[model samples]
Target: MCTRYRVGASGKKLAERYGAVEAACDAPGVEAFPKRRGWAVCAVKGELRLGTMGWGFPPPPNGRAPVVNVRNLASPFWRDALARPAQRCLVPVTEFCEWEGEAGRKRDRWFSVPSLEIFSFAGIWRQTAAGPVYAFLTCAPNALVAPVHPKAMPVILHPEDEARWLSGNIAEVLPLAAPFPSQLMALAE
Candidate 1:
């Protein structure tokens, strides 16, 4: 799963790409991390709006790291948020990172389109006592990511599917929640 990602484009470009109205809020810089503020595109009252939201859901009572990558929509923890289409969001990412090797010796390798163009992750958000939080969905890894992290990869949405992801019903979005094609993506140094 992707715990870190890069969104290199300016807030204005992100808004333009998704046809969202820019909100007068502070946007995150090139690199984004868990618990940090970053931009997300969500439909509010049928209008696309771009704004900032914290990276993960509120931390569990045990004080472990907040939940970041969401996979099982049927899980009780995610059921309410997933049931509401209003909470669905699109997380624009230029690239995402995965760590390889032992914990102490782990190194980073980035993944993105071969051309390094912007892409998006299928996401969901919700209001919490702390504030609004968002998490990107993940699925089984594709060939490109299997060697590095065989468990899972983010549910990267195609550019053309952005609107449907935000507005479509469960059936329309379910078919799209799979690993991206390996041919269009590569590991960046």
Candidate 2:
């Protein structure tokens, strides 16, 4: 799961690239961790808008920490949030990191498609009592990520497919949820 990722561009550049308004809050840098406030391009009332949102869903009623990765689309926990296509958002990232090592000796390795300066994760967001919260989807890891993290990796949307992910129906977005092409990604030590 993508518990951490990187967002290095300024809000103005993100807004311009994604055709959204500049976010009004601070943007994260090379290392954005879960539960932190970050900027995402979300459709507000059918218009794409860049806004600051916490990178997690609200804690469960039992009061657990917020969840950062959401992979179960069929689960009741996310059904209401995922039902509306408008809730979809694009999480801009330079790369995402995965840990490699034993429990206390883990080291981070960053992964990205070097051919593109920026990319987006298929994300979902909603208004909560705390504020707006957003989380990205994850899928089984592809070859590149599987060696480092055998479990899963964030579902990255290709630059050309960003609009479809943001506006497409469940049927359209479902097909786009697979792991990104492993050959296109590069790893950084």
Candidate 3:
């Protein structure tokens, strides 16, 4: 859902607010997420760590589809791969991109954010022998993002709920996504 974003002064403020310590801005193709560039995954050291994952969530063995949206998690095709809810470290991010227009004449670069300056995104990760890989989980768009991205949006997190999200439990923070509010995120007009 949130495929692209601009990380300017706003990102700096977000980093400080969330106490995002080490930044691993090696998200392979930075353009995939736009101004948010190069897999900007943030970690809280002993607390938690996260970053932009390969947009398409490549399925496990025998599964060739790569799903970036949770909507597919329940699909018969991917339910097997996503049957289990994941609680890995993820930050949906304060802003992301969507497109406007018909397929042939479609326009990209739809920027979305919350009423607040920046919001954290929900994500999941697996413990690997090397380290951790994160993905910005997706969900249906709220009224705000619906017109912009028709498909979905990454799970946006409340600033105060960061700790709870780290636990990987979706129930505790389900209510936050409701009552979507409009934020004043400008695209450098």
Every candidate's lDDT? 0.87, 0.85, 0.50
**What residue pairs clash in candidate 1, if any at all?**
none
- Any runs in candidate 2 off by more than 4 Å, and if so which? none
Candidate 3: tens digits of C-alpha lDDT, residues 92-181: 344566767788996765554536555556554443343444455567766766776767766666666666656433455444444244
Give the poorly placed runs of model 1, Cα more than 4 Å off: 59-63
- Write down the RMSD of candidate 1 (Cα, Å): 1.6
- The predicted structure with the larger lDDT, 2 or 3, is 2
Best by lDDT: 1
Distance from true position, residue 166, model 3, in Å?
Answer: 1.2
Better of 1 and 2 by lDDT: 1
Q: Per-residue lDDT of 44-129 in model 1, one digit per residue for the tens?
A: 98799999999998755765888999888667787767667898999989999998989899999899885637789999999888
lDDT, candidate 3, at 21:
50
Over the stretch 1-189, how does candidate 2's per-residue lDDT look in tens digits? Answer: 778888888888888888887756766655778888887898777678887888899866885888889887787887766667788899989888998879999898899999888899999999888898999889899999998999999999998889888887787787887999999999996
